[model samples]
Target: MTARRSTFTALVTLLTFAGILVAPQASAASLVEVTAFGDNPGGMRMHVYVPDSRPASPAMVVAMHGCGGSGPGFYSGSEFASLADRHGFIVIYPSAQQEAGFGKCFDTWSDAAKRRGGGSDPVSIVSMVTYAQQRYGGDPGRVFATGSSSGGMMTNEMLALYPDVFKAGAAFMGVPFGCFANAADYPPGASRCTGNGGANRTPQQWGDLVRQAYPGYTGTRPRMQLWHGTADTLVPYSLLREEIEQWTDVFGLSQTPTSTDTPRAGWNRSRYGDEVEAYSIQGAGHSLPSSGMAAAALEFFGITGTPDPDPPVPGTCSVKPTVNAWNNGLTASLAITNNGTATINMWSLAFTLASGQTITSGWNATYAPSTGQVTARNAGYNGTIPPGRSVDIGFQATHTGNAAAPSSFVLNSTACSTG
Candidate 1:
């Protein structure tokens, strides 16, 4: 009898601990309807994932849906729930207004949406965020968004129209076609998706409009990521490429890169200044492939990435920056500047060298010649750099027999040219 009672007590104790271990940390899971207040919210329905711990964690993100889709569809298909589970972050999926017409897109770039009186989607988005913070536990400081197709276009529009509302945004296969074009050509000119009383404008027109708006805009441009398939039939590749070029040019980015096919079968990758980047897949089209784009984008959004199996810190790198040389290699000095407000723990730059010449030696960093890469380690020994500080790391190398010194280089993941 004594033995049985002891065994039962032990079993009960173990079970209780196990239950505690498995319990979720969030306070409550709430599904709230964000009323458009009779303003026609584009039929947007909102659902939130709030944790048990209130105010302790950041309510990380809210993702909007594309044309003809709802919040549930985006949440279930995008695998955002799993990300929420892993990161202990809250995610809200919000729907857009739907109309009983041939086209089902939000008039993202419309001038009406820009004004206070118009049934603006940006206002609705801001309202949703405000509601989440007030009623639900949302950390306004860390809010971000990622959208697809029409949702992506809205993401771009929101960045331009409501730049202060979000810290960051990712556009997957979406571009603000009409907003960037000439207002006059757009019919009801500049009224959102349907221009001039609901007429649609072409990509060229959209680009022209954006150019005109660029000079006088006073708001800061938030961080953004643009992902599109090279072969996307739904949104032509040409339009996306033009937008990419236009944005980089507008930003005054100096670096220009030639595309090279990545080892990943159909992938082609190119880099401009640290400000602009693009990836194109030769045979891939329309949608995201299973592999790297999302992960890459997540990194771009400042989200923590998969811990490097072996953190790349504590490594030394080499570079032989130079000018003109018959060997297709020249001696030059490379300077790395920290643009962000915080100190970077570590950073790496990867690029291919001209077929023959190679990097010989780099300072305060290490060089991996075989991979054509450079990695720097400043942990512990190197202190934090004050905001807007610059660090100079140079390299020394001799051009191999009869090879021309390499003229261009990539820094901190951005391409750089001599000119």
Candidate 2:
């Protein structure tokens, strides 16, 4: 709900290397702090994560933190980082310094923050996006935004002000752009403006405000995906409708939903053409991003992952493999034993996957060439194996048919005894 991940205590351990431009730490994990990315009028901090195994020109997402939340905190809390790891995309987590009653927050209410290139939090955010594009060679057309609560409000703001910059956005429990006006009244009047006052405005008026942010801008407006709980009291649930109103109008689409259905049992979803989609979670007040929401959001962004196979298959496998099979997916774990007389350092286990199996992601060890003849290498921390010791590696993959173990295995070029 409120401060969804703001209470994470181990953010420092997760973030450690701030103000340093280092290489990707592991196969699929690295969070680096970039100081001079670009103009940062909002005085926000930038933390970027680029998975070791990713596309050459990866898609990018700006993940803003809620009030009282830090970039590293949200990175640890939200599933976007893991999804980024799976899809090989870049994530820009910006820490907001401005206070929004609860804690640190992106400037959603400020006049400067609301307008396009008006020079505030939104400007700082765009600077981060630009830096990601320039530094990481990110795909410009696939840039996106998603955040929770106040950060979610910034998500809406980014889409509204810089439609050219983002292809789409997902706002979890957020308000409409420009709805947080009346800075003099602040949080006291926040309820009034977002609740009774702002919710009453016609859809046209709300849409006009977004249009005015970047006046005369004639480009494809980024699509929107909004999530809100029915019983939210902090930022009333009614603003969900208000956000739908604003974006629908901005896209010149009808307010009447084109389709409505339950994405999950208690979660109702309404789609307005392809421009906007809103999810209302029943009885879930202010609480957001409930489990698989991040995955759904990334799917909406068209960042589908791939196994993209490794190489040609080889001989008999030499590892003890245990598998958990499901309908179309399976999880496999393989234990490799080092029975050599001497201690071995820096191990690479190579195995040929079964036919029709494609890996999505793996842990403990880094797997390359996700399918076919693949190689699993130890991470930075697990590079050594004493004699008579074993190291376990695992992967999750999608299978069209049989979920079998690797046909052959080779550990650092020496074929071991078959299991």
Candidate 3:
């Protein structure tokens, strides 16, 4: 047997000896199995946990398992369910169908699983998200995915394939999206992408892979949290860099991190403008996130001990947009008027820019995320507006071809008329 397999076995045995291992079937006691959740194209099973306390629109998390693991098994081994009980959110544990006795593994290597609406594990997982939304009034805007090893790979896949669904994800010991391509020989299969393959792609090359996963996708990409061990042998330790490169490029961040610090002793973290964050556990092994990870992941997902932001009420504002267009770019202006009864101390205008359209610079307000669902917050000079008064903010955005106007104007949680 290869040393990696031997080490994997030894780690599993050690976790089992430490009472961290639980049988897949035994997890059913805590998580209710949901068969016929969808067409089951991936042949995966679904299990869910609903806390007694729930918000009117509680958030939902899809907690996936690694190879040789089942949904309930992960549900038991992971802290998400207990966190759900405390936080009033729901958790879904998905169990992949055992493949050729190789162990139950989510399909991150298959073409069917890589693309959008391709009808495989990914489609099945989306169906589960839809099921949760329809059945439990789950907040569509707050869905998230997380996993370890194989499941971690799927977390990257989920964000890439369905950014419209997931706001963010935390992937543990995961490789870059499409890292398994051309390498079906993993874990006994001789592959170049894992275990000393030496992650050779440039950041743009890796970003192209993620963009290709869902062609023509122009939405604001979901954020990512990456965790990996420095001493991993099953998956190459260098993959953490590849994953970082891929996602930072997607979020339009430079390779250099905005901040670097140690969250805890022995755990080094680098954050790329909050769009991508990588945590390196020094001297750790395969399958990272030893403990106290779920809470941190939840924090990244904005699910603090409290619930999600309350749904906004009917808007009492107006947005007037004017644009000066060129062949490759445009300068757009917005007039935000306050129609509320009281004076506004602070204001933020939220809108969605077309795909490929990125804000290069702006005046009168601060723009964030350049593209996708963007927030233009008032600068210090324009933070206050009296009733019946208007604030003018303009930004210059670059676009390759599509120069359509931004839409879905929301000012401080109030819907605004885009007149």
Candidate 4:
């Protein structure tokens, strides 16, 4: 009886601790619906959150939702409403329409949606900003925009199409403006988005894309903040590099990062002067990080009194590859290791496939093959690689004659030796 009681007590204690680990944090603000209060040009539903202590002319933020996510969900998930409550700001969550095949995603990839001064989605979002400033006593000059995933892509579109409207914008897990020329090019997963690495375009070439988004615009461009999970398989982590390069060129900042901050073990910030800041959240997946990203964005826009905490020492990670099995010029298995001090949230592996070999199917990653080059991004579950841990991913390929392993392998953009 004594042994049984001790085991039961230990089990109860462990379960309690587990519950604490997974419990959701309480939200600081409540969401309120404002029906038909603004011009519904794009026919979007508005869910606004206004703090009780909102001062006169409070700053307004237009928050957008990702594909298949509603405004309320975004409000709850991003904790934007909570931040608004604390900071005395107004937050507008614009819900998207269910387009024919794309579900609830803003048409940011289309030319019509990217245009300025029209009744399209971009213009409609700007109208929301205008409405917030007019009816909600929002500061027009201090208005900002932010979103995640597809919404993040829309955020980029807004900044480029209406540079004068937004003082600053942040995009999490998004692509650059005009990355896809049209709807047909819009792949089901953004991991396949074009211009992932700027397509080797020069700074001028990339800047020209943004310039063309708004014709004859010479206003001061809005500042930009980009955040990406290092382990995001849905959107390749390499795309973050392209986004920074494109924006830095548009802002005419040097290519090198002006400042690098590791706010904690798994967070990193690379500032390109004051106009552009890119955050790489180590061990984070496709979701918004809980480590004060919303607060940091508010501070960057100067809308909130809270300042970002100084980053701590950055974490390091190393990658190793091992061939698990190769069969009859047809099947193969590979394993990778994270041999570093911190957890890896997102990762990309690149290698040269043996000549005449073609990948047919892969698991635990988004596989892309191009003329002797192959790149695989982390799938949702396999991205988090803890320190001194390992994960296995496998692929099937067809080879003409020889099925030898390639001579080189790179992980997270760093070269690695095969184990």
Count backbone clashes in candidate 2.
Answer: 6
Each prediction's whole-model lDDT (CA): 0.52, 0.79, 0.80, 0.73
List candidate 1 segments past 4 Å from native: 1-43, 51-59, 100-103, 114-118, 177-219, 255-267, 289-292, 306-419
* TM-scores for all predictions: 0.54, 0.67, 0.65, 0.66
Clashes of 4: 7
Q: Write the per-residue lDDT of candidate 2 for residues 389-417, one digit (tens) a residue.
A: 77788999999988987767877556777
User: Best-fitting candidate, measured by TM-score?
Assistant: 2
Model 1 residue 344 lDDT? 33
lDDT: which is higher, 1 or 2? Answer: 2
What's the lDDT for residue 79 in model 2?
67
Clashing pairs in 3: 185-189, 315-415
When 1 and 2 are scored with TM-score, the better candidate is: 2
What would the per-residue lDDT of candidate 4 be over residues 157-179, giving only the tens digit for each residue?
89988898999999988888877
Tens-digit lDDT string for candidate 1 (184-252): 322222333332223244434544454454345656555665667654555655545654654455455
Q: Write the per-residue lDDT of candidate 3 for residues 128-166, one digit (tens) a residue.
A: 898888877899999999998888989999999999999
RMSD values for the candidates in order, in angstroms, are 16.2, 15.2, 21.0, 12.0
For the record, the alpha-carbon RMSD of candidate 1 to the native fold, in angstroms, is: 16.2
How many clashes in each structure?
A: 50, 6, 2, 7
Residue 29, model 3: lDDT of 27
